[model samples]
Target: MGSPICPDCYDYLGHVVWQYHAPELWRRAIQDVSRQLAARLGVPVSKVSKVVSRQYGRTAEMQARGAVHFHALFRLDGPLDEGIGAACGVGVDVMVEAIEAAFSRAQVQAPPTFECDQSRVLRWGEQIDIRIVREGSRTDDPDAPITGEQVAAYLAKYSTKDTSLAVPDGAHVHRIKQTCAEVHEAAILRAESRRAGEEVPVPVDSEGRDHYVLIGKWAKELGYRGHYSSKSRCYSVTYRTLRRRRARFQQVTKSRCYSVTYRTLRRRRARFQQVMQEETERAQRAGKPVDLAAVEEALLSQEDESETSVVIGVWEFVGVGWTNQGEVEIATAAAARAREYAQLRAGKQ
Candidate 1:
């Protein structure tokens, strides 16, 4: 759960940048480890069985000082059954060596640094911990239950998280906002370190909006949005495909079309509808007659029945559109005209 970072010494931009690349770094590290194992065993990368199947995994914020580090969990297919043990050998010393080697060699370059300092570096934290699977064991203990599920879950969770000033979500909005403000106030803090910079952290809870307002510095991220994960093509199925399959199955079961579209729909005359509903309720309570005004109000108070009522505005880049009161009024008027025309036709009949 810890990376080699001197909280007092590490650069803030470096910390934020690392958070941005952590997912890629982890993937590369795992791939390198697999390659190392394959080379040692004299087998193909595909042949070596992945003991842990990462159904889900995440990364979380690990802070040293104002700087950030990482703690990750990776889920596997099963417990460390055979391939990992055979690859790393029997003792924990061998496991540690293999892990260290993979992490040490694994490097992610920053985009073409022209500066004299050239921050494009390849270094992992010195604080490396490797453990084997054992139930009811401590995380620090080398024999803890590092199950496939445990690793995947751990990595997946933190994959989308950063330090206090990293990103925004419902659970930690207050803390994130406060930290962002602090970082903003400190001139010592680098631009990237101030707030998630390029990396966008997703919320642990999926039901809520990916809000960035509570943590304003994150507005630069275009709404706390970024790629939360990076996996090799060989890893497994994708989330989108998985969801599509589930939806297809549901559609088939329900005997409906599987196609779906995401578009903006406007409902106009909402206020008028509300007023009509209220009046109807009052009439019911008073045992009064429900007449033409009530019926017309209810019918005309909707966009589907009248096009001119609500004005819908769309922002192409942002992909959002909504209706205002003016549009609602126009649509209501149109609905009333249609009703009048219908009544005229009925009179002629």
Candidate 2:
């Protein structure tokens, strides 16, 4: 379920309220909505262990209307009490009803404006979108269920987007600019009032300090103040954990700093072939078949032990690829020789 602030709240906050205070108002409204939802679901605030809930918030802008809105994902685990209703858990229909009821009941008191008092009630817009996410389908697909991957990717895409309003000529841009100008004018008025030792029209905090003077600071965002992305603590894995896991993987797979010369490689290959030949000869002399699996396992164990041995040498860098056509022919001849050797070893086995 997604809900956007009403037009009246939008205009009042963007034009009349200070930008610094806008975030606080938004936080209050979101909390109110959450509280209402919890109340509807019969979840106690003090005892949160009964129901596990996760929420993620995404702030987005409408290109045509140039207004900012929120997109949120709510995952509810259970009602837990089987005695209340069905055997497994709460029904999808009941959850949807709770969402709608919460949205309707959620309201915030708007700050006083020049034309009106502070008693005005602000609520969500009429256009509330509610969609049930089921397993194995998408929100747009009515026949299929919603997959976890799809929902995660959808929310992540919106979370990383720029929250700035779109560029378009017309009343939307004009109104945004006009509201910013109003904020600036209010700042100037507050400053002048302070200098003259007269009362300011803007409200003050408990400390008796003017709070609306910082409204012009967030004019770039059209006074829509909120984080681009927010989530509950238990919603997902932390970035630090992911980075640490990656670091550990890299450490495990990182190659040791050692140099290998062409001569060394040839020597190792020759030693391997000689060992295999000796083993085959021994098996024939004993009139017994060679155990290929045992031979492979022994070779692997030897390799693992040899990995810790330090090879001390400084080799000059040779140019990549075959230096000449003769070198390429030589490489091909060596590969053919290796293949012949392998075939001979296979026949012996």
Candidate 3:
């Protein structure tokens, strides 16, 4: 797909610059989409935003032609309790029109690479897919709608996907990597030259972001520098909030996917029995009576020796994951099985 007729006609510089500013382009597109909605609804831009809101999740993937592609799911929602929702008038047809028009008009300029001083025009590819997601089985129609669950699961899978394997090895891919490295080196020189009072074009954006200063770091990513997946801020709560509320109080059950199983209770009981026996034997040896309440408290308040150890070293934040290898393996296996089952169900649907 890398120019089936003439590969040399492809603009490698434009491709990389577009890849780098992909996020900004998407942001501008969303703004344009809002404006389009406002115009269509005959409402002011400022007031429309207050009534209609858009929440979306975007994931980037490597196309067969070594270019970048975005698969986004936009959800038109309203204020939580403000009662100013899409129920007022907006529908799926309006959303589709707005999004298509927005992307077609969305454009962001990219700074010139070190090798070339020519400005680059960054925008999405001509090919874009906008589909309506609903909850139902597929029909015999060629353009049948998809289920929300399917889109969610698909995007979620791609969000964490590694594109290295998905990208085909070719001269086009290698050239993109080379362009990233060259652009990065050029940016460093430009920054240094500007600091030395030289007449170098400024590479900073309006927000002072050195757009391609670290382009070389992502050379392995085929010149793409944006996040593989992202969601709107209002789309959901912070991960910190999720981690804080990971556990919820539920009735003790002997069976369930994420519930406390009977084996877990059996293990706790076994540990409690051992602790009670040890304390009783110690009390008997000292010719003292064993308090039942004290035994129960001891069992409940059980702590590791490390927990009571002196704090001599400073603590630092580390990346998140399972606490041990066993948990990691268990989680990995469960995730693999879940993915397989999900695929099977999707096929059936």
Q: Estimate each model's TM-score.
A: 0.39, 0.55, 0.64
1-349 per-residue lDDT for model 2 (tens digits): 0212554455534443433343554566555545654676677754432553424444554344555556667655433231121122545565566567666666655444332334345566688787766676445655566676676787777766554424455555566757766756665676677779886555665666445455566566666555656665444545665685586345434455545556546765776686688778877796555544345444544553444557889989877998899999999999999999999999999
Query: Can you tell me which runs of candidate 1 are displaced by over 4 Å?
Result: 1-10, 16-24, 44-97, 109-117, 135-226, 230-237, 255-349
Better of 1 and 3 by lDDT: 3
Query: Lowest summed lDDT over 10 consecutive residues: which window, candidate 1?
Result: 79-88
Off by over 4 Å in 3: 1-9, 80-89, 138-141, 207-210, 236-238, 247-349
Better of 1 and 3 by TM-score: 3
lDDT of 1 by residue, 1-349 (tens): 2223443453434444454455567667877766665455565777655432122233335442323344543333332333121222234443445556788899886431111223456467777665654454236544446665566556765665554444333323333334444433332223334354533232212333221222235423321323445453324555765785586345423412433322211222455466667876876786544343455435444424322336679656743443677877888899999999999999999
Candidate 2 clashing pairs, residues 3+ apart or interchain? 136-145, 137-145, 137-146
Candidate with best lDDT? 3
